[model samples]
Target: MKISPKARMNRLFTNGGCLDVAIDHGVCNEPSFMVGLEDMPRVVDSLIRAKPDAIQMAYGQADLLQSRPEKDKPALVMRLDMGNPYNATRHRTMWSMLQNADEPIIGALEMDAACVVVNLFMLPDEPEMFRQCVENISRVRADCHRYGMPLMIEPLVMLSNEIRGGYQVDGDADKIVTLVRLAAEMGADIIKADPTANPEDFHRVVEAARVPVLVRGGGKEDLKTVLMKSAALMAHGAKGMVYGRNIYQHANPGAVVRALMSMIHDGADGEAAWQVYNRG
Candidate 1:
């Protein structure tokens, strides 16, 4: 049988690659780094105006999501999990379910959601953490099928330091490949991951998963750098990217979002995207 729910989600994207905005940060972290997102409604309004192909938001934002004025608002990727400090070996890296992993999917179904997403940390040494990750994905995979919704698994491989930039190191490429394949084996319709610094290595991640792979927008990279890297990612077979801080933290969020949309959907190079951003 065709995965029709996932295939039909193409309606949310343009004819080209996807440009997805992730507004789910606040629920997992304090609002310190999210300059514009502290004003949730305003930032949501800005993002909506920019017209991203899809958006990822926390389960708590259901009311705000429903209140959007646009009948054709972007597809909703409901976050089905939350982070707890105790879930990870490093207290700061915790990404686990808020309640039962299925709860958010159930609520999202009621809102006519397009997809459900959960975060996982691939820790080979910690059997309990590994088991929890597997259990969460397995449970959510079943729930998605029963509800006829698409499921997205976001997997990260991290070291013990809890350093934000640590995962981008040299060995991250192979580890991400492992994570991608693992997510696929667990039955994810889509998988989100960090882009390896070496652009070509990202293809290993895409090829390994054999599923749509969208790179996560980690930390607050410069707009030009992110757009440049996004071009490289798309050239190397990435589906697209999910950005939170890069878009929302900009002085002109709508402009930044539009620039990224141009790059992702229109295939504009970094210079062209910079021009689009500068034009505003």
Candidate 2:
């Protein structure tokens, strides 16, 4: 029996939204991103217990989550690309490239993944990098249609600045909206995008993408801030969130995930979500 793409995509949502935990930072090659992920098994197990709608992971580590014998495991979103823009410690030319182009969709099928993610980056003075990202998405989109798999496009606007000592997420609304719309136009089944600098402007991103837009949790922030921002984004039409460090780097990852779930599914405001986080 084969599952349809619509069915696989439906599994990634609950009550009209989703909360996807992202542990795919290992491929970024940034040691700072590895803080809570030192033990793969423990991290994966803890996340499973947290029970997010899905878990986004790179090819190598995805097995740790999907191999579980339990019938209620989180759906997997396999990352099909790797990039150097996340390397913050040293100065280097930034690049985002696919790990494998030819058989990525077939490989995801073999892994029983529900969806695949690839990057569509907008970087300053890096037209070539942007072109490469567009090409990768085009190739992946064809395979996704062929295999009946959902494709999630992560469109980011990044800048190399001394303040962050490397490429950092840029929240410029115009840039983000343009790239997000482009990603959707290019055939993204789902769009994972960063919130604009002004929370009110995020609706434009959602409108432009014309798809289920999931907010990207960039760097780690204080609990209250994260909850408040999430609430604001959701209020402005975001479908949900795809959080990385904000969940995994917390003192209690599971607690944070549950709190976020309350916001995504239960219409919990920031204060209510904060109480949920504290209870954990």
Per TM-score, the best of the predicted structures is 2
Residue 45's lDDT within candidate 1 is 71
Which pairs, if any, clash in model 1? Answer: none
- Candidate 2 has a TM-score of 0.96
TM-score, every prediction? 0.89, 0.96
lDDT of each residue in 165-220, candidate 2, tens digit only = 65588889999999998998998889999989999999999999887999999889
Cα lDDT of model 2 overall?
0.88
- Cα lDDT of all candidates, in order? 0.74, 0.88
lDDT per residue for candidate 1 within 242-278, as digits (tens), equals 8887888878888888888887778788889899999
Which segments of candidate 1 are over 4 A away from where they belong?
A: 1-3, 31-34, 85-89, 92-95, 101-104, 123-125, 162-171
Most lDDT-accurate candidate: 2
